[model samples]
Target: MKSRMHKGVSLILGLGTACTIGLSSLEPASALPWQQLIFNGVQLLQLSNISPQQTVALGQNIHQQVKQNYRLDSNSKTNAYVNRVGQRLAKASNCSQIPFRFYVVRDSSINAFATTGGYVYVHTGLLNAVDNEDQLASVIGHEIAHICNNDLINKLKQTQLAQGAASLAGLDQSAVTAIAYQLAVDLPNSREAEFNADDKGLQYMRRAGYNPKAMPAFLRKLVRQSSAPSFLSSHPATQERISVIERKIANGR
Candidate 1:
């Protein structure tokens, strides 16, 4: 599926356009314009018309949901370590203006995800799985790219649009809610979005003084461990993404 695009301050098609109507009409007390309002309401608009403030709010909401669902590390040192690395990577990202916060979920699943609100969650399994700081930075950079690109917001906006359509067609709130929740959790981003994020992520790692080559190494590990049913395994490694990264590295050299 093609990712939706935001048409500056005007209403565009798909999720961005729908969010312009949904969020703006719902919160009349806010002074945000339709363009700003739509940007704030959806993750996809963050890269284009969405303002930083809206992105922060969306991140906060997603963080809260994540905290509620997963167990956060209680060890202050672990939290601090994750935050320090995350901060370094965030500063190197293209969207440096977005305040990126990182946390380690107290789960054994080897998975990490980025929220539209500039929040990144890394599972303990992933932390333990990586060999060095560069590999870890590669993972962080990838997730940061997802957030900077507003992939999550776009996914959420699409969910909201589908739910609204379902409601209009006589679907009950429960049904709409179920579908929306699934989409939000699954993040069905297109292959193009994945590839774009990988390319941008490598840039982030390189800018942060990390060994950009670690990305391919980490991906190789993921490919070898594909049979393992881990949280990180949720996103199966693909040869296409690795090939793109190799080309990027060659071009950079």
Candidate 2:
């Protein structure tokens, strides 16, 4: 399993608890035997060529269904505030060219997830976890980076391909939408994807004039917790992640 871990990538959002307990270093999560057989990790992926218009359309469909199912924060102020912060980083994004929209989920879990076409959801628990705007930006920027880099899109592509759907060429629209939500809540991504998100998120923070140190600073807080955070824990290197981000900040990246 160790040798076959880098099969397919899953940008699973809010994947419950991480398997590591008191783990000190980062290591890629070993793919399940089944995953190893069918999936290809993000590092080795050639993403689906679903058109930009199709992606946005699919995203809108997914977004609408998600809003209906998730207990979203109804406070206009909170939603507007998150949207403002998100748009700033969205502008700083390098690869994602879509109009990003941010929403607040009325949950008390320290989690956040992104899906296709520039939709980002932040948990109220995650909101309260951040000590300041910079930290919040750190979280938001990370999610934005996932969208910018098309992690979600690639995950969907991998799933479709693994199941022999290949592309969105003729699949049922609702099924594709369901997979997006399923991946967000159920899968874990590659360590490479997390590193990419951290790197790009940090860059977005800097470009948006937010303190980039907040990336590691916030992750450190999570690690100090009695239990590891799923967001940082999905990949084993919470400590290593902090070090990498700190190095980036130190080098003015």
lDDT of 2 by residue, 198-222 (tens): 9999999998999998888898899
Tell me the lDDT of candidate 1.
0.65
Tens digits of per-residue lDDT, candidate 1, 1-253, equal 1112122211212333333323322222433422333332232222235467766765665555566567889889888988888888889888999878888888776778776768788889898989998999888888899888877656545444544432333333233222323333544455666777888889988888999999888877877884653433345356666787988899993
Model 1 / residue 67 / CA error / Å: 1.4
Best candidate according to lDDT: 2
Error of 1 at 144 (Å): 0.5
Q: Lowest lDDT 10-mer window, candidate 1? A: 1-10
In terms of lDDT, the poorest run of 10 residues in model 2 is: 1-10
Deviation from native of the Cα of residue 225 in model 1, angstroms: 2.4
Model 2 segments more than 4 A misplaced? 1-47, 166-171
Kindly report which residue stretches of model 1 are placed more than 4 angstroms away from their true locations once superposed: 1-48, 160-184, 229-237
